[model samples]
Target: MNDTPGWASPGSAPSDGQQPGTPGASAPDDRPDDAPRPAAPTEQPGTDPQGPGSKWSKEQPPPAQWSAPTGPQDPAQTPPPPPPGPGWGNQPPGGPSGGQGGWGTPGGPGGGYGGTGGPGGGYGGAWGTGWGGPPPAAKPGVIPLRPLGVGEILDGAVSTMRTYWRTVLGISLTVAVLTEIIVILVQGLFLNDYADTSALEDPSATFSELASAMGSALLGSGVVFVISLVGTVIATALLTTVTSRAVLGRPVTTGEAWRDARPQVLKLFGLIILLMLIAVGVTLVGILPGLLIALAGGSTAGAALAVLGGLSAAIVALWLMIRFSLASPALMLEKQGIRKALARSAKLVRGSWWRVFGIQLLAAIIANIVAAIVVIPFTFLAAALSGDGVGSFLDGTGDFGWTFLIISGIGSVIGSMITLPITAGVTVLLYIDQRIRREALDLELSRAAGVQHPAPGTTPGS
Candidate 1:
């Protein structure tokens, strides 16, 4: 098989016994039509005979070897196509003996494997014109080496979770169980009074009583929110490492993921807190003027301004949130500081705000839906097992006793075990997709994955 690369153009030879485009060709017929012609020279064969050592071979071959055999021949002894040379086995694309399709078609252009023609003809005849789409991309792991679509991004996330479920679930379950235990203990021991929120529900409560109840409730909720955020931060940090390796088709143990992520954990936590504060600060600034107006006895005007300002602030916050949504992955994967990670995220998100927003929103919706599907049934079962039963729980009057707390916390833990990896994986994959579109990250990933790119103009795996 001749494996040399390149295609010969398909055109007829010149009439002057020379290939077209060769150095010599008959001059254009510009001579006068009636110009005199020289007498042609003729020689007798014996008169032109040369002496010994002439630049020609004079040996004669056996007469029968010059032609094909006249009798029937054994099919098993049929010869293969002639070795690679001009015209590459004397067949053209779709010739009488060549099959109709594929590079491998017998006697087709580019004498591919399985063809009667020797495998020397290059794909010059039908590369772009006949070969359908571009070649499939290299897929080292969960995603192909290209800019990802929405479904691909989601699928990559789920694939990462499924492919490395043991390590992924281990990290998530540990973090979730620990976080939930802390929350339950804190609520049971320190917030029992705040948990009894009936005082705020009373229609005739005094303003001071209502204010106190709201403050206590806020305190309880703030504690829970902070705990949840910490758990999320830890899970994101570890899973970032796992997902990054998963992209390169590398399997990582939990210990390895932890070691890789440990250095960046504190910085990731700080970045998350900073982003939260920025959002909250914007919100506070929006309502500050209205708050001042209200304190100065302009209550009606203050309320209107606060509503309008709050909405504008919310819009700004949402924009900022989406803009910095990738910061966690950036910080973890790049081992970047809070400021640098935030800057990197903003830079990557510059031209693709809507795309990033839609992907993030979609992932969140999917993760939440999955979590709700798992947690809701467990919650109802817990309620029924508790003294309140399902009706009282739904009515919002059930006491959250130890039974309720433990049962509901178990549901929360299980739900988080399923969801944490997915959310983290999607965020990491989105970061990678953006980098691929903007910076050609796929080449780097291919190198890391040990994928060998084919040489230009050569078939892959040739």
Candidate 2:
């Protein structure tokens, strides 16, 4: 193992007669090519708790040990034809859209985990593409240095789960309860009001009366919703920020959290509103085109609408993600304004959008799965017991509607609450990492944590 830091010239004869770029290639890239290998993924700066910098293992493994390029890589090198069979993005490459990832799959030109002897081959990371999605996350336990996607989000979630499952569960339970309470209360108070009012009950009110009533109702609901939304966002962001601070081995005082988070409140909310606006605009545009086409007599209006909606949603989702991935960290740690934070996020996530996207997607899926397992059965049972429950309650039927509703509510609340803290904590942490990756945010975080970086030549393993 010839140990070297940073990118090396292509033709150096590594111990196994190998070249520098293809660490795990088993063979070297021809000297004529003379390109350099990408730096071994770093352990991230400011990661060492008690040291000056991260504890990076300088030992360079064989090219084979590193990921091989799975599909035709090399922007200059075109891919051979597809291997036949249902190959959409699966096509070899060289086309406009055939190749998905920089190479064949998601990550990039490198072999990645899928190619058998990838970085995560034997004792890779903690959750090597298994904790959730198609594969586990590449790096676990350590926070990323850039904006993350759902899968990475899940990996962080799982990592946090391993450490604080009980706390997370409790939080989830709390969130679930709060959510259910809010839902029930709103329905009972407002929805029930409409259900009971004669004017509301009447479907034939004049346009003026209807407009007035609707406007009144909507205004009232909007006020409440705005209040609730602001409160929830502020509360959730603070909770998440503090919990993340704690998770990252930093301060956990409520006062400290409030102090650090208070000013950033409006910034975070602004980001949220920005995202909502973008989502609304994209959805509206996509839906409009489809609707217009449908009105103009398209046979597959439904299909077009669905396609446009899905595509627009996917693009907007990705755009918003790239835009805001690292903003939380900027707000929480750098104390930047929302616009600046968002810009920081975009800057940090310049080249690695998909990876972040995948990680986040993974996180969402995990939380969803956990929530589902706990909520679905109870939901069914609730439906069975109430006037709204599935089966009509006969006089002889067990009077368990209340029980079912309460249980379901509890289950939902528990799941949401617990998941919320964990998710929030991890996501915020990851956001910090993305900034660290880009702007050495870890150094700031470490300073906040009062830790030093390891000096040169001090290997983590050593």
Candidate 3:
């Protein structure tokens, strides 16, 4: 090795215009342009006192054989950052695992070492949930209020329809058609009845004619109404069974849905009929109040009507809401009396009536709108067809006596098919929710829905 800084052999041609450090050497400015100087004393392998003016350490360990450390041995390069403040990192000193020293043993909790007898070998209580942190605060309505994926929900509905649409739709439609036929028959039998009874027609008439027409129409309509009511109840029950089965991913026979529907048939009918009565009563009272107010002849009768009707309807609606929110669940899951079912529904819907109401209304409105869109044209057709049957029933009130009845019945059936499933789905879901609230249904459902059932008698709420 050359003793001089950048001095070439004493007699060699000078390199790069040089000044040599030695008394008689060729030179490249004594700085050697081809090589580089170490930045720090600790970075250089050997001291270079006789080299370029740069300082270098003689015993620096070859600068770690790699690039200097920058920003902590990157987590990717090092073992996942010591797992924060605890030794989830590795086994500590004298530990069982083959961790390079200072790592704890795998037998940390029980009899092996000084760990708290925590389940996973460390202080189990030391972590909030071992899931990383405190449970996130549940946002109130924001979590579930938004409509879920339409495609998913509709897909479930479509599947339900596929399995159930045949029997349910067929039965409901048959009942509807039968009712419509009866309505047309009765309309033909007593074509003059509506005018006699209605306030819009002439008052004085022949008594026998009026009596005959009125009696026939009343008997006829009553029969149709009863049939329609029964049909609707059956439809609701069946739809609920189908919807529940769909949600649970279990296939059900239409016969099974019908069977399940049997238990709640009368209850559903009674409930619906009761609601209808209340609605009629509400409309009467609501309209009466408006009329009375208007008879006082205020300049604001319309507004008063709008306001009063709205308030009254709202009250009635709320009551109905509290009453029926859990009806389907009651029907689907319980084998009890109407009063008990109502009580169960009430209890389940206690604090969440408004939510249930909103959801129910949403389901109803959506179903009704969809049903209406589907049925309106069919209604027109039925009415037109019936007009041919009762040519002069109204002479020309659009002559819609028999036509109206027939169309109304047919439209009702179409409406029921579309709406019943949606209503059932909504009610059943609410029922499940109530179960969650009253019975911890979420956890229970999680368990029930698990691969194997959870512990034998570990019911949800319990």
Best by TM-score: 1
Give the per-residue Cα lDDT of candidate 2 at 426.
56
- Order the candidates by TM-score, highest first: 1, 3, 2
Q: Model 3 misses residue 27 by how many Å?
A: 40
- Name model 1 segments beyond 4 Å from true: 1-129, 195-223, 453-462
C-alpha lDDT (0 to 100) for residue 118 of candidate 1: 31
Once superposed on the true structure, which residue ranges of model 3 sit more than 4 Å away at CA?
1-80, 84-155, 167-192, 195-230, 270-314, 382-396, 401-415, 446-462
lDDT of 1 by residue, 1-462 (tens): 321111211111224344434443223344343343221112233432233423223443443333334555666886764443432333323433233333343443444432334335544443333334345678989998777888888999999999999999999999999999999899878887555566788999864466477768877997898788778878988898899989989999999998998888778778878977998799888887877786688877886787788889999998998898888888887777899899999999999999999888888898789889988988888899889889999888887778888988999999999988888888899999998878878888888899964333332220
Tens digits of per-residue lDDT, candidate 3, 241-299, equal 66655555556666786787776677777766765576557656765766566557553
lDDT of 2: 0.53
Q: Is candidate 1 or 3 superior in TM-score?
A: 1
> By the lDDT metric, which is better: model 1 or model 2?
1
- For candidate 1, the per-residue lDDT at 77 reads 88
What is candidate 3's CA lDDT for residue 272? 64
